[model samples]
Target: MTHGRSSNILFIMCDQLRHDYLGCYGHPALKTPHIDSLAERGMRFDRAYVQSPVCGPSRMSTYTGRYPRSHGTTWNSFPLRVGEMGMGDHLRPLGVRTALCGKTHMVADRKGMERLGIAPSSPEGRLMAECGFELWDRLDGLHQRASGKQPTHYQARMQARGYRTDNPWEDYANAPLGDHGEALSPWHLSQAHRPARAAERDTETAYSTDRAIEFMEDAGDRPWCLHLSYIKPHWPYVAPAPYHRMYGARDVIPVVRSDMELRDPHPILREFHRNRVSQVFSRPEVRDRVIPVYMGLIKQIDDNIGRLLDYLRKSGQAQRTMIVFTSDHGDYLGDHWLGEKDMFHDCAVRVPLIVMDPSPAADATRGTVSDALVECIDLLPTFIEYYGGTVPTQIIEGKSLIGLLHRSRAKLREVAISEYDYSVRKARVGLEMPVADCRMQMVFDGRFKLVNVVGFRPMLFDLAEDPDELRDLGADPACREVIVRLTRALLDWALRHHCRVTVSDADLQDAIGGEARAGIYLGCWDQGDIDQIIRSGDSGY
Candidate 1:
């Protein structure tokens, strides 16, 4: 695979995969044989991050090469504003053939999908087609499992065989109910929860891998950009039988470091932890059961990656293709007594990023590692630069990592930014909710991390010293100057990127008033700690 010439780019992404989960990354427990093998033959990034800690924002950042705020998508359900220029849209004009298989959570309407070449119209289809991809295996209803109608032959078979539901088979529903028994749990009745899909009907790696292989074979001689996205290792914690049973619960170590919790941590953290302690940790046996199930989900995703890698090797395209494996964001997985994401903490923001260079280096940079700070936004430009495609000016905020990829240059950027919005927070609480008024930001430069909490005092940590983030050096007299410098950096980056600005006094007043206006059931925590607060009142009424 020569550089500057036409080459196949295979982009593999997993939902909610964390960096610490792979064996190569030093996770004593996780069994990711395929990913580890890929790491051995590739360059791994020790400090890769996502623009946002959630699905929509992170994926948007990766595809557009722009910050979430810059791209205008800060939360889920808020579609990437139509006409927003993205990597796919920009790639279409070039001669490269673009194709995507599996989970594309980015918004693409019917017209835009057809233009991108997807047989079925999905939110992501139009955007990919518009970008220049002509081949696609469209699966729109894979995520929600097409409701009253069947969308694909696989889905049709799933419906015919039937699924297991908890209640009267009619009201019981076909999908697996990720139990929302904890009063504060996001799965409560008042929460707009739905069984994502039947455990048996879930689309595994086989579904997407086969499609990608078909695309590669059909592509024949022409150079193509294939976006191979996987939806596993996310939600419901459901994996197929053998995968589900692969890991024994006894072998898995449930390690929740009390230190990961920040002192006076974000209000949301407090609330989530309280629920975990009461509803989950209180029942050790039940908590034990959840880990194995979650690990089972991860194993399934790994197996899927194995299948894809095997296909590439068998087809003799292994050496010719530039392979990149990453995740939209990291899952909490009970770290710091938390489950889902939305925090500036490393467990939430830090993600696994592996880039396998196809060209052979002198010493086989294979298994080489770089602790350079990189974000999801950097991906698009890196690809564009590698493919000789022009990067769009107005929308792109990411710097290309091609230098780091080609020559192992580490000092690309001093800091990386991640954003979070209030919509999902409010929805998790209850609604007809007022807009989220609070914001949090992180500024980390390899050695140090500064967390800016709106209205509340900012927190600074010498990560090199305080690895678990248990100590708060913000108020310490000795580190005051360090705090001041980091604060300035955070503000400068925020203002420059337009991601966020220091909260004003007026903003604080607005937040207080907004919390009152939202009409949420207040309890131990106040509006300032909204993230830590959960509406336990069973009034879906």
Candidate 2:
């Protein structure tokens, strides 16, 4: 395939959206018709997983096509190193104008830039600063912390719309207005059931949708990729007036957890369950108060998706533009006696992935679902393949799913990997562990999932038999073989993905006979060998 000159990509990402909540994914109550249509017109991956369960590291892994271990930004606030390349760094050179609409959770490597003496005002510095994205409207994470002391685009828009509160985001946008016009803070779970103080159109979700459309209009006729990211369904659990009344406790799915999971919990998870978020979610009423609003936020996201799709259809960009919809990670929402997405349970690591390739080549597999194991890093290479760029295997560890999107999957991956660094999490503090020892690795083959901690025994779950993951077989002598096999697989995976980005497959292959051809033949003793080396152009011998 050559460069897709007429092709555009709408990469839609939502924060903290789960796979099971969408209509197409078999949700019983929530109706996400717009998001479901992506599956009907494209491919839905049932077993997609993120590299990390947090925002920054997972998004970095998606952007860079490398593991969190490989990229080195292992937590939420950690900065991506200066040398790491992002999706824009790869796609921009190929004429795909990559632009951001909402949050990337990107923290720039200012120290590395200073050491290299690169000015932040320079083009290269700016690219590194924004994780290689050409910004359109960067409403990153919150109204206040978009950057240190810099007022955000969302804040200005809110204030311009007559919301003159001290903190418009927390007060007007996220807060609920009482009957007497008093502010009911979203921080309290009791007030989360009421509608937000702001109007539906002025909420961040609506603003993000409008700004994405604006970005597309500005990039008319150009081969561009608009990363239409939304910072909703993530936190504060607040929805605008119209959506606030959409659901209640009756609409929320029954929580999938068991008391048995709490009895013999792993040492690491024991501390995690004792944390505030987990303890708060562990209650039934708390879930009833919060989950309905979460459902509303997801419904709000689905509606915006419909608006974006409608625009694409009307503007005639629907036929040529590829659409990839996914989330940074899954929200636990009290699934396994946990919350806030820090564990390797399916609720935190398993994410939704749907891709629609608007080419005739994808006709055969359209509307089909695949159980093939996938990682979020696969998106970067998929974009590269769609744009006809060679995927540098040395730099990108993920395999492209273009083949799967267009045709039958040739083979299944041996295992899917995910990791979490609890160094910044309260779990580490409660346990009083060193930063270096505050991490855990997960290796999940098609059936069994194994998590290896620094000093504790491995935690294993047989997903095939125990889909709810209510039981742990790590301590059972009967499951010793499964543990040993997965441990070996993990060891092999870790050793192979070492820092070898500077070395390519061709470079390593050439080196096999390169030294002998260079005529410094260490083992050559015969005159015929020396004569052959001399007779060769370079290595004809």
In the range 1-541, model 1's lDDT, one tens digit per residue, is: 1353557789888887777877778777778898888888888899998888888778878887878767677876566655466666666565567777766666544454445555545555544333323437544223444456544544543445563322211222123344562212223322212332334324445566667777888888676778887776665454455555666557567554565454565554555566543335334464465556556667766777787788888988877778888988887656666667867678778888888878654135678898889988888877776677755544577887777766756467888778777555633353233455455677888877877765556767787997866666666789878878878887787677343333343455435434434655445344545543334322122
Residue 21 of candidate 1: its Cα lDDT?
A: 74
Segments in model 1 whose C-alpha atoms lie over 4 Å from true places: 1-6, 108-125, 128-135, 138-145, 148-150, 157-202, 259-268, 274-283, 361-364, 426-436, 497-541
TM-score of 2: 0.95
RMSD of each: 15.7, 2.2
Per-candidate clashes come to 15, 0
> Model 2: per-residue lDDT, tens digit, 196-276?
988988888899999999988889777998898888899888888788878888887889898988897888989888988
